[model samples]
Target: MIRTKIISTWTILLVCGAQAGILESPNYYHDYAPTFHHYHPQPRPQPHYIHCTPEVHNVIEVIPPPVIVRVVEKRRQTAKDLLDLICRALTDMGGIASEDNPEIGARIIAKLNIEKDTATLIYAEWKDGVNYRSRRFKRQAAGEDRVKNELGDLLTKAGDVIESDKEKLSPAAQDKIDSRHERAVDDCQADVCKSHAAKRNRIKEAKAARKG
Candidate 1:
């Protein structure tokens, strides 16, 4: 009977030790349990953007407009012809040639009021040694008109010369001379004389046309 009782006590001690060990175990189950993860998801890598090169295009250059040039024509006149006409008129007047008589060159230079450049001879006349007159002709309209008017006066004097020497010239010679004078008059009227009148008229007309 004593052996039986010792056996029972030893069995009870073993059972209590087993119950305490189960309560102290790490995997013990209860009403609440802590959750744990061994494999964590790695942070999603950031998305990368691909770089692209820009396309190059050729540039066009702009040019400015060109400038326009205008040209103007200038008219110039000289006085040489008027001196010759004057000398011829004087000779036709039947005056004796004298050194004291105005030379064509001197008369032209004197009559011309040109402050610059030389006056070319155009026409000349002399009465005795002191009385002399000359016309410096220009082709300008103003000068041409003056020459035309003066030429008409000269024609009257020329007629007197012919009348005074009517016996010296045959009727045919006088007719011929008269015809020449008439032709000269016609030319002057036509603005074809080597006088300033024609040139001035032409220039005036040209300027008017341009304005129009």
Candidate 2:
């Protein structure tokens, strides 16, 4: 019985010694302990919005107006006016020489109006002879008016042509065309009378010779 009791005491002390050793060891409690983990929350997605507006349009119109035009007529020159211009042109020409003034008279001496029924335009011209040959352009009024004379019409046409062309010439050229030194008039009637007298004398001489 004492041996069994001693053996029991020894077994109890061994068990206590093993328990204390386990407590004092370094890795013994750590190896048998439970583990813990921690986590943080993440941010949520944001809400989105979009705004819209309407489109607008505009329209316009254009217009135009009408136009008008008018024309006017020109008046004709009268006989009296034409005759005055002719007279002025004749006065400007100083003498009568065909070479100096070939288109018209060399010189217009004078215009005579007799009793308002007859008109004579006397001008100097060069004929076949060496000297100036005097001539006349006479016209009787168709009725009572001297302005209706045919000579006036002829002269007026010539004056108009000259006047129109004068615009194209130099002033000096125009002056030369219009004027010359004054000269004497060689009358056509004196020449005609002289010829008649000479013819009569020849006829008398022939009659005398026939009788002999």
Candidate 3:
């Protein structure tokens, strides 16, 4: 019986020592346990800058307008001057005499009254036994009136031709023609009484010779 009791006591102590060792092993489990935690990096932002621009302007130039001119002209000679020139040309051509035929002079003067630079009428007068009678002759009249009328017609025609061909003649040439025409008329009418004086002298000499 004692042996049995001692063996029971030794088994009880062994069981108690195992229970204490188990209870002290809790500190080792706490020191070796894993912890729950998370770590993250934060991002930084960049700075912004502002840009500037410049403005421009344009310029233009203006111009002025042009000018215009006009011109006017006047006649060189009058119509009366042209008429006198025609009459003078006729007398120079021996178509009419300054004396003896007062009828021709009267007709010319009357015709000149109508117009200066135009053709005029010239009538023929015949001695009807004692009195002078006036008559209109056709284009074939053979008297001084016909000659004068033809010359006047010629001057009128020449004036027309000159007007048509005005560009061909220079101003100097026109002046020369005018001067020549005037000189011819003046020469025809110059020294009228000189011939009468000479005739009277010849008559006086003849009378003296007869008396001697």
Candidate 4:
């Protein structure tokens, strides 16, 4: 009975010792318990682009339209223009007038007044260096119609020459020659006449050749 009691006491002490060892061990539940760990998210990397390269494209050229130019014709001058030019020329040269003559004749003289716009034409008959009869006519120096027409009429009435028909020798008198001096009186005069005859002959030959 003592042996049985000692065995019971030994068994109780073994159980207590086993319980104390389990409480004192540091890794008793190391594998069986849930584990916690601190985790940080990492950022994703971005792709790199080429920014230094230049882009290329096709270029088109545009042309503008051409500009046009117009030209005008110049006007032609007439006989009236010539007359006006003459009048202005005479006016610039102060004025012009005819001189008296000893021979019996009619004369016409033109005078431009100080105003330069009016012109006067004088018609006169002269005998023995004296003016026998006189007439005065006036007209404008320049214009489109009246001046030109009036000047033309005055010019016609003035006539081209101042000599009279009476002073002119008759055909019978001109034809009549002195028999005493029929030929040239000097050798120099005869040579001059020969030269003039030769010149006339050369001109006639040239004209005949051209006509042929």
Candidate 5:
């Protein structure tokens, strides 16, 4: 009986030891179930509310310089050049520059009237040469009103061409042309008279010789 009782005690102690070994085991208890934790799902981050305006990446306003258009240059002309142009305009009007000048004085000289914006035009030939008048001496003065009027027309035409107006010529301009025409005609007549006097003197000398 005592042996059976001892065997029963030993069997109970062995069962208890086996249970304790299973609970304290590193591989089964510690490694498998270290800590029992409850995991609750976290809410996602809400995006920050921003203003409607788009963000400017660059500090300076990124705009290219405005396209600059170049202006066209206008033609430049001087007053004297304008007068020469007017002379050309005159030639186109079927008027000879100087009637007395078969070819002597074709060129002109110009004076400016700044107050009236007018040009005084005269042929170069009129100003030269001297005049000697005696009772028998007669020199035709250069005063061709017809040529003056034609020059006036030319001046008017040129004015219209430049300013698109017929009132372009001032009174001063007309006076200048008139005076020039008169001078040119007088010079031509004087030269003619001188030639005639030379011929008359030669004839008189021949007549006296014949009488002697």
Candidate 6:
């Protein structure tokens, strides 16, 4: 009976020791009941960019300047110069305009007036047609000094070309040369008249056409 009691006590002590060891163990729960562990890797950190460079594109354009030129005009000649030119032209044409000439038959009819850049001469002549027709001459030439020089040269040339010494002869000997010069002056006047008349007629006709 005693041996049976001893065996029972020893069994009870063994049971208590096993229960304390389980409570004091570090991995008691894991050792008691093992579970599955699902490990998930952490996401890697992403890099940040500042994007300091701008996308804007600006274009600049430059324009060129303009060029300018200046022009100068010539001065107009004086009226006195024009008047002198007319006298010079008449002299060049070998017609005498001397108011002092005693021989009135050799004198040309001249009307002197001041014009632009030159002188004006109005010459009248009697043309013998069915009756005596009157005509006017317009003489155009340069300035005073130029006209005088040109006319003098022309007169000298005329005297040489005609080969007649009228000034050295008596009045009877100079009759032909003097008459010829007078007739030339008269013819020149007649021509001027015809031209002026034609111009007047043309101008009148143009006016009539414009009116029409």
Best by TM-score: 1
lDDT preference between candidates 3 and 4, better one: 3
Model 5 over residues 105-147: C-alpha lDDT tens digits?
A: 1332111122113333342222232143633223323333333
Which candidate do you rate higher for lDDT, 4 or 6?
A: 6
Candidate 3 ranges with C-alpha deviation above 4 Å: 1-142, 182-212
Residue-by-residue lDDT tens digits, candidate 1, 33-120: 3532222223334569976555423454668889888887643322234334433443433232112233432332232223111112
Model 3 — which ten-residue stretch has the worst lDDT? 123-132
lDDT of each residue in 80-100, candidate 2, tens digit only:
443444444454442322334
- Which scores higher on lDDT, 2 or 4? 2
Q: Write the per-residue lDDT of candidate 3 for residues 49-82, one digit (tens) a residue.
A: 7654443233345566666666666443322343
Candidates sorted on TM-score, descending: 1, 2, 3, 4, 5, 6
TM-score of each: 0.26, 0.21, 0.20, 0.18, 0.18, 0.17
Screening candidate 4 with a backbone cut-off below 3 angstroms (N, C-alpha, C), the clashing residue pairs are: none
For model 6, where is the 10-residue window of minimal lDDT?
Answer: 121-130
What is the C-alpha local distance difference test score of each model?
0.42, 0.39, 0.42, 0.35, 0.40, 0.39
Clashing pairs in 6: 82-117, 82-118, 82-119, 83-118, 83-119
Off by over 4 Å in 5: 1-54, 58-78, 91-154, 157-212
Please give the lDDT score at residue 25 for candidate 6: 54
* Per-residue lDDT of model 4, residues 1-212, tens digit only: 99999999998888767655654555352222242222222333456996653432344466778877777764443324424543543332221221122121121122223212332321111112232252321122222234334443332222222123222434332222111111211111223334544664699799999999
Backbone clash total, candidate 4:
0
Give the per-residue Cα lDDT of candidate 4 at 137.
17
Query: For candidate 1, what's the RMSD?
Result: 29.4
